[model samples]
Target: MADEVKLYGVAGSPFVCRVKIALNLKEIKHEFVVEDLSNKSAHLIKYNPVHKQIPVLVHNGNPVSESLVIVEYIDDAWKGVPVLPQDAHEKARARFWAKFVDDKCIPAVFMAIGSHGQEQAVAEAHDQLQFLENELKDKKFFGGDSINLVDISAVFLAFWLGAAEEALGIKIVTKDKFPNLTKWSDNCINCQAVKDSLPPRDDLVSFFKMRFGKA
Candidate 1:
């Protein structure tokens, strides 16, 4: 018997996009059940009662929540097309970078574009981005040659960041600022799986414009 897999998430969510990209990379076949976060669905509530968030993966009745956790689960469950590195140290590095994306980078990026404290926030954001830029000095992807856990985890930087920049009329990621990261992001978003899984760029830009009152 085949395994039953279902992902509950809303469109245009980067966390949700992370799961979708991981599944696509692994070539996993699953049903994508969209959830309206404005009005929570019973299944979403049932699967992720603790957080009550989307991007919940249900495999054969077993539920997994959290975007990165779900990606790790997908990698572990599927042996083919490894989503993480095989080497112990490298795999650990991938996990570390993935965690950094959420713990450090996300907050910095948000603050940089936010209304209050633009000067300090932009500096902090660049500091964080420098770490990533240095990390990608000569690498094509965070996973080295191909996208992996780190790349999937940081998918927001590839697409959503651009939308935010366009809508807010600010440019954080620039060729002069982060050449390597800029190149790496280009490769990531252009990948067939990542491209297919991403939400429409224009829609996301509009969303940012509305939210930040930049429209």
Candidate 2:
């Protein structure tokens, strides 16, 4: 039998969604095992002992943890639509932005949502979104006309950000404030692969409300 690809992930997790989008974009076939994060399964822990987190990709019994790492791996392991840019500089730039989204954008958005009514968190997220808006200026997508690693990395901003906004009753990616980002988010969600991979908006909003105790 051919080696099977198994993904252990949580529903409504942005990180897990990133992996799903990559897989769907690559046309990779895999079995998805939804994990209950509140009571993580032994299979999840065994595969990813260090993080013991969802979004673990188990290929031929080899487990790969971390969403971005799994994305790169999927790009390399499959010969489908390329995720990373072909040029060296462009690839590096894509990677830099992906890391930036993970390290900076996601955290800022979460802090803003979690700390609803806090001026500091909201301001911090605004600054970060402004930076992203500037980066996205003059581009249809982060990869320029097509979704790429950077776009995938920023998937949370497209879907989950709206959910956070709804849950917290706060607005961040407004047209007047972050026009570029707002447009990019629409472009991203409209992409067939992304649209297919995304969880329903209402579900995401509910998840955020429960997780953040907002709304």
Clashing residue pair totals per candidate (backbone < 3 A): 0, 0
lDDT tens digits, residues 1-215, model 1? 98899999987999999999888888889999999888989999999999999899999999999999999999999877889898999999999999999999988998877753377788898899899898888999998888999899888888888888888888888999899989998999999889979999999988888888543
How do the residues 11-114 of candidate 2 rate in per-residue lDDT, one tens digit apiece? 68889889999999988789999998889999999999998888999999899999999999999998889999999999999999999998898898888888
lDDT of predicted model 2: 0.89
Alpha carbon lDDT at 204, candidate 1:
95
RMSD of each: 1.3, 1.4
**Candidate 2 clashing pairs?**
none
Candidate achieving the largest lDDT: 1
What candidate 1 gets wrong by more than 4 Å, as runs, is none
For all predicted structures, in order, the TM-scores are 0.96, 0.95
Mark the regions of model 2 whose C-alpha exceeds 4 Å error after superposition: 1-3
Local accuracy by lDDT, each model: 0.89, 0.89
